[model samples]
Target: MTTSSPPHDLLPLAGDFDPRTRQDWTALVADVLNKRRAEGDRLAPDAAAEALVTALDGGLGTEGLYLREDRPLGVPGAMPFTRGRVVRDGTVPWDVRQLHDDPDAARTRAAVLDDLEHGVTSVWVHVGEDGLAATDLATVLADVHLDLAPVVVSSTTDQPGAARALLDVVGDRPTAGGNLGLDPVGAALRTGTTPDLGPLAELVREAGAHDGWRAVTVDARVLHDAGASEVDALAVAVATGIAYLRHLEAAGIDPVDAFGHVEFRVSATADQFLTAAVLRALRRVWARVGEALGVAETDRGARTHAVTSLRMATREDPFVNVLRGTLATFGASIGDADAITVLPHDTVAGLPERFSRRLARNTQILLAAESNVGRVTDPGGGSWYLESLTDEVAEHVWTRFQEVERAGGVLAALEAGLLREWVDTAVAERDRLVATRQRPITGVSTFPNLADTAAERRPRVALTTTDAAFAPRRDAAAFEALRDRARTLERAAVTVRTIGAQRDFGARQGFVANLLAAGGIATTDDTTATAVLASSRAQYGEHGRAAVEELRAAGAERVLVAGRAAELGDAADLVDGEVFDGMDVAAFLGDLLDRLGAPAEGDPR
Candidate 1:
């Protein structure tokens, strides 16, 4: 059959304009920078033009421009799989794995079957501890078609039991897909135990008898929840995987078979571009490791399952988490993950209801069916930014992996507190970024809806444990703490004393109000309130100072100016403190909450 020519075929796309060179772009950047430059202050042309570049962690960055690729990143389903490890054959590019954690076997079974009937391709069940009982595994899977739909099981401290229960459900099935979810290093990291590789022998051997089930999983979500950077997570995964491989080798498994026995679970967040890049980077780096081990080309690439980050979910205004999940799923699919699980939006709130699970399942479904995001192979493959970013991540992963190895592998790194130090540093930086609202979390720290009622869910069973080597850290935790305490305050309303008209005070007023509401405190214009804030558009030293003094005299115990403390200048002493952008919000809110009055018992947060 012959095809008709498209409209663009008849025209030269950029015909009216000359091709713009980097030099021309640089000149324009320099001109723009000149306006922001002070009088008589000059910058070198190159430096001025390069100021548009952005700095990211792991020495990775984005330039004002990326040169077109001089070298090709190879095709999909091949060695070094930078583009992708596999080219999907259908519209649904990845497995839709739904997580089930309800302790009720009947409840979990119903949700599992419902999800599968809708769109979920696999099930990852939490067993033991606070989740479904390991003994009840059969009850949960009795209705499930084990051969057709894979069932993976994870436990806090009972992998052997979980695996045994899962195996019983499978019976003599010749074809099954899913992992045993075994990670000794991950367990050690979480429980602060010494590394245990003894379980690999029995588990790996038993898993070999099953056609599609893998016994090992390198779950980097442990580090991700602990606030490890993307590079740190990847590096830890590599180190952990290496440690596993060595153990498997000693257990007498062939290198080729050993590689197939393992899979990876990566944490995907709202940063979609970085999420995709990190996955692609994992493939590139792992492929090289396999090559060095003399493993075959096809077995080299890691099997990846992307999970929407647990650490990114907010307890307050959790509806925003739906958007975060969508972005994560998009990134995971475009990066060619073998499977993906998006946590329910209300995950942090409590046990997710059916509504939340349905939304979670349909998230990937709509992305595939409606958006057709899965129609193409490696959707982000050819972009200059993506390719460059992937390379940058792979390089950093290798460097960090080498560092971990030099410190005596993943276990030793954990024992020596090396890994903890790495996570702590990254966490502090993340805390700073989140606290300053530099990386604004919508509906949490930014644009908070104080009047909105909190989403309700069934209370989940809580699990106690030994002191964890790496405790989970959430970006919104600090702000949420403030919000929690603000709710418990005896006097929850603070007077926002605006200076001049709404326009005069609108921006700062809005800013101050939003900031206060995030902590669950209400705002008012009542000058008789104990705490009064001068939100203004007028100059602080000129029009704002008198308003602060008036508020102070009107039974107001404390007065605040909502502008730069520096801008306050001579009027600084007229008010208690300044409320401005880049201020330490947690600190500011914390101090304010303390001044207002403590909760009935103590600080609830």
Candidate 2:
């Protein structure tokens, strides 16, 4: 049987343009830049034209072949569901899941009731440490109607006990869409100790006896928090899911039934497009896996749960994290996740206050009810850019999955430290980008608020035991540490000396000011400041030296110039150093703080 091709007009740019036209467009761009250069503009024609083309084309030359292709995304609820699994017909809202981690059982119970009573559709409880103990399951969920509002329990070391406690509460009544959240592989990966999968399998068998309950959870957010790339995280998630399916099959469970027993959890970050693409890619890859296993098309698509990225949350200017969570939640919705959890803005600080928890829940409520973002299925469907990106992400993730399979699967890869090595490399590159400001963390590395008070401290109840496996890390941790050092000083101030007119120095002035403020150093125009940052777009022929000397004469102990080093000329000798893009911002600020007599280590403010 042959399929008919889509109508010519229905295809993207079909017959409307030719690839050869790119040469003509490039020539036209070059001509414009050449004319500008002839008119005495200090621009390289070829370079300027190339940049213009890149800006207009929406793809960088460095992105290689991945950015150049436009792939078709099939209809939603179909095989290889790159678009989505279920068609959300504007009536059913995505599940708004709230996380409950308060260790006080009574408080946790009250909070859970409050959340469910207000807007939360489901509750995710952490059992142990900063979360409630498994023994408190009955107390915390006493008021909850298990059949109406689903409850998900997560435990690090006590999955079996937690599952049993939850099941005991669930007792006899058919569970209404709850997940046992028994993840033995996740526990093993985190603690670097193999957990006996027997209990988990038993729990799965027991849960299988009930309706609307899933036993296994494949959470890839651990890998993501440990600095794994998108592909790496998705690959690990797929491998874990496959491993669970195999294990269950080995235990006399049907393959399709075992597949249905699992759910996937991934991280959603502030990068909306990437988050959406990652989720889309995950579903497609999982669908392919199910197809290979001969599962029905309806059972192939993954049931995804998206949690806001922990690595993206900041302790500094944490209010910005609300915005991040909102964006991530939106991205997750567009990506067609079955459920989403928006972490409280202050989560990185300590146990979240009532207000923070309310805000976290309300964020999803507002998106679903107010903005009506859930009114459409696969909102990003049919967009050329999203489709192309989704396909690219799926390809890369499948390749990584293949590598893990070749290495004898996820557990073997983890035991051999190959997964950690991959994640560490990604972490190193991410750290390098963060340090150099290539990947600017909004509150910590970019527009830092120096005058903002520190986040309120809360005594955390220990929840999970730390192990030697891939540890959680935040991209802003190093930068926040530098700021901590600066905060210890009685007075941390840097003078920004502007040269030439406002237009000439405005950009560099702001640049140097933000850089200094990022390290908790206030920028001042006062002569009392010991350090001076000279900012200018003007050439440093003679005026630059005079500015540096003037700062030195005005009680400045160290002088720094924010401009090209080559332009410093004779002023290079007068200034302590140069500040520019791609510089080690943390190191530069640390040295500056030390030179300015930062308080000794362990000295209290």
Candidate 3:
């Protein structure tokens, strides 16, 4: 049998200027800049001009590079599914899965009921240490109809106990629509100890007996929170799923059936396009895996559960997290996830209060219901940029998957520490970028609220069986620590010595003030300040020098210049340091606080 080619009308056509390449665009930009210089228009600096060219050419870095050759993206719901698995019409919206890990069974139950009563369609319960115990399953899920509202349980080390408790509550309900989420491999990776897969296989077999229930869950969020890149997360997920398939097959289950009992959980960050592309690429990779196993395309599509990235949440200026969660939920919806969970805004700080949880739930509700984002299928499908990104991500992830296969699969990699090594490198790089403000975290690294009070909430209980090998990390942790240090000081304000009028120094003043505030330092214009930050534009060099002298003469203990240290000329002699973009803000703040004689880390003011 031969398959016919796709219709020509359905394919994308080349534009009239198709022959024009990125090089041609670069040349044009250079020519325009030169012409502007000749016309005495005072063009942007050389560094800034080149940066613009790079941004226009989509060549900022590996993450920024994308090719146009991967266009058209094929049809939605087709093979490889780079667009999506199914063309969603507006009738059915993506499931809003609210996560509940409150240790109090009563509170967990109330949160669940409140979510279901509002807009949530599914419940994800954390069962184990630091969360609801297995014994509280009955109380937590008391009125939750197992046959109607799907409930996914995340049972880390206590899988067997949690499974038994949930099974007892579920009884012999054939129509129960929920997932057991028994992931031994994930637990092992998380806790640095191997679990007995024999129970896992048995649980899979038992859970497979029910309808609309998945037995094993491949949680990429574990890798994600541990600082894995998107490609690494996808590769690890595929390898994990493959390992589970083998486990179930060894236990007498068919490969196709084993695949059916698996689900994927991934992290969705504020990078909406990257998040959507990663999800789309995951489906493609899974499809290939299914094909390799001789399964049909229809049986290969993955059921994805997307959660807002924990790495992106910040304790300082927690309100910005609401916006971040909104964008992440939008990305997940665009990526065509089966269900999405928006973690509470204050999740990183501590156990989220009712108000924070409500905000998280409503973020999804507003996007799905009011924004009408669900009405369109593959909303980002047709764009040249998104399609190109999707294809590149798929290729990169597939290559990583092959590497994992060669390294004796995910389990071996995790045990050998190769996976953790890769993730640590990525995490370090991400932290560096966050530190330098190359990737500015709105509230943590930029526009921080120095006056913001600590969020009043219950402290999160520690998990007893945490793996020191692959412990979860937050990108904002270092900055938050600096901020915490700042909060302890009795007097930690910096004075901004504006050189010249507001127009000359306003921009630099704001920049310096925001940077200081991010480290928990307030800003003042008084002479009583321990340090004075001199702000000025390039044209006001003399003014800046005089201001620095004035501040020093006025008995300011230390003076810092804002802008390039070299641009300050003789003014640099009067300043203690320079505050500018790409500087190590955290370290600078730490040194500043110490020099100013602020209280130490544990000191109570």
**lDDT string, candidate 1, 455-499, tens digits:** 878888766556756677788899888888877766778888677
Residue by residue across 1-605, what tens digits does model 2's lDDT show? 89997766555756776555545555666676677465665445345555653110011112212233455557888888877888876766688899887888888889999999998889899885446789999999999888789888887778888888888888888657688897787776666577567876788988887888889888998888888887898898899889888888888888888888888889999878778998999999999889988999987889999999998888899999999999999999999998999999999888888899999999988888889998988988876667777877888888889999999998888777878888878887777778888788998899998766457857666434446666678888988898888878867888887766667678888988999888888987787576778887667877877777787788776777887666656566666767575688887888888877743334363
Q: C-alpha displacement of 28 in model 1, angstroms? A: 1.4
The CA root-mean-square deviation of candidate 2, after full C-alpha superposition on the true structure, stands at 5.8
How many residue pairs clash in model 3?
A: 0
- How well does candidate 2 score on lDDT at residue 507? 81
**Model 3 over residues 1-605: C-alpha lDDT tens digits?**
99997766643566544586666555665566666365555444443346463220111123223345644466666778766777776866788899998898888889889988888888898989767899999999897877778888896668788887887888886544888888887777777677567787788778877777788888988888888888888888899899888887888889988888888999999988888988998998898888888887777777889999998888878888899999899999999998999999888778788888889999988888889998888888777667767777788888888888888988787767778787877887777777887778887788787766458778767765545546688888888888777767767788886777777568878888888888888888687587778777563366666777788789776777777755666665555656475688777888888866654334474
Error of 3 at 602 (Å): 25
lDDT assessment of candidate 3? 0.79
Model 1 residue pairs with clashes: 504-537
- Estimate the lDDT of model 1: 0.83
Q: What Cα-based lDDT does every candidate model obtain? A: 0.83, 0.81, 0.79
**Every model's TM-score:** 0.95, 0.89, 0.89
- Each candidate's number of clashing pairs is 1, 5, 0
Error of 1 at 228 (Å): 0.6
